[model samples]
Target: MPFGDFQKSSKDIQLLSEHILAAECEVPGSGYNHSEMDLDNCLGDDNGNFQWGGRNFHSHAHNIIFHPDEGVAHVPVLRADLDGGSKQSNVNLGERIGNVNGHLVFRW
Candidate 1:
C-alpha cells in the first residue's frame, strides 16, 4: 500500500481530536507543519501543557506492530520452487485461514 494510505483522513482526524478533548486528554494542535519541521514554533511555546505533531512524530523513534484480527493471516503463501504449475499451485493462505475487513480495522 502507498504511504498516504496509512494516514487517517481529515474528517477522521477531526473526530479523533474531538474525542480526545471529550475524554480530557491532551489537546491536539498543528504545532508543526508536516513538510517543514518547525522546531522554533514548538520550543518557543511552553504552556506547560502537552502537544503533539509531526515534529514529535518524525523525530521520535517508535515501532508499530500491526496485528490482524484473530485467526486472520497477514501475508499470502507462495512456493519458492515451481514443482507444479505456477498459477495452479500458488494459493492465498489467508483466504483459507479467515477474512479480515481491512476497512473496519483501519476505519475511524
Candidate 2:
C-alpha cells in the first residue's frame, strides 16, 4: 500500500485521491477469497493529471443455487482499471455479498 499523501480539499474541485497497493485474503472451505490493488490519482487543473490503477477481485460462493439446503451465498466483486495503458472501469458485484468479519477502510 503506497500512495497516501496528498490532501487538498475545497469542496471538491478535482484533487480527489486514493492509494492502496495491496490487500490480500484467502479462506478455504469452499468459500472466501479477496483482493484489492489500487493506485488512483486524480488531479485537475482541467482534468490534467489522471493516473488510475485498480484491481479488485473478490469471491464468496458457498453452497450456491438458491439456498440449497442450508447454504446460498454470493459475493462476486471484480473491478479492473489499469491506468493510461487503458483498461477502464470493469465492475461486477452481482448483489454485493461478502463480509466475513469485514474490516477494510481507508479514508483521506
Candidate 3:
C-alpha cells in the first residue's frame, strides 16, 4: 500500500482507540473487575479528554505522545513502543509551554 494510505490508516486506528478508551475512562469503577476487559494495561486520562494512547508491555518502555495536529506528534520517545504512557508525564511541560485555545491560554 502507498505510504499516504498507511499513514491515514494509522491515524484512523489511533482515533478509534481513542474513542473506546475515552468512553471507558468516563465510567468510574467500570473496568478492572471485568473478565472481558483489562483497563490496567491502558494509558488514559481521568479528565475525560478526547486524547488517549498506549503500547505493548515490553522489556523497556518509553513515551509515545500523539496530539495529531501537533508538529512533532510524538516527542521525546526514547524507543518505538507505540504507547503514550510515558508521554503522559510530560503533558505539564506542554501546559507550561502553553496551549492557546482560542482566547484561553491553558498554562501553568
Return the top candidate by lDDT.
Answer: 3
What is candidate 1's lDDT per residue for 1-108, written digit by digit as tens? Answer: 322221221112111111110011111353222121122122111122112221221122112122222224333222111222222222221232211221111111
> Between the candidate structures 1 and 2, which one is better when assessed by TM-score?
2
What shift in Å separates residue 87 of candidate 2 from its native position after superposition?
A: 4.9
Order the numbered candidates by lDDT, best leading. Answer: 3, 2, 1
| Total backbone collisions for each predicted model | 0, 1, 1
Q: What is the TM-score of each candidate against the true structure?
A: 0.16, 0.18, 0.19
TM-score of 1: 0.16
Please give the lDDT score at residue 26 for candidate 2.
28
Stretches of candidate 2 above 4 Å error? 1-81, 93-97, 102-108
For all predictions, the C-alpha RMSD in Å is: 19.8, 16.7, 16.6
Where does model 1 exceed 4 Å of error? 1-74, 84-89, 99-108
Which runs in model 3 stand beyond 4 Å of their true positions?
9-11, 15-57, 72-108
How much lDDT does candidate 1 score?
A: 0.20
Of 2 and 3, the candidate ahead on lDDT is 3
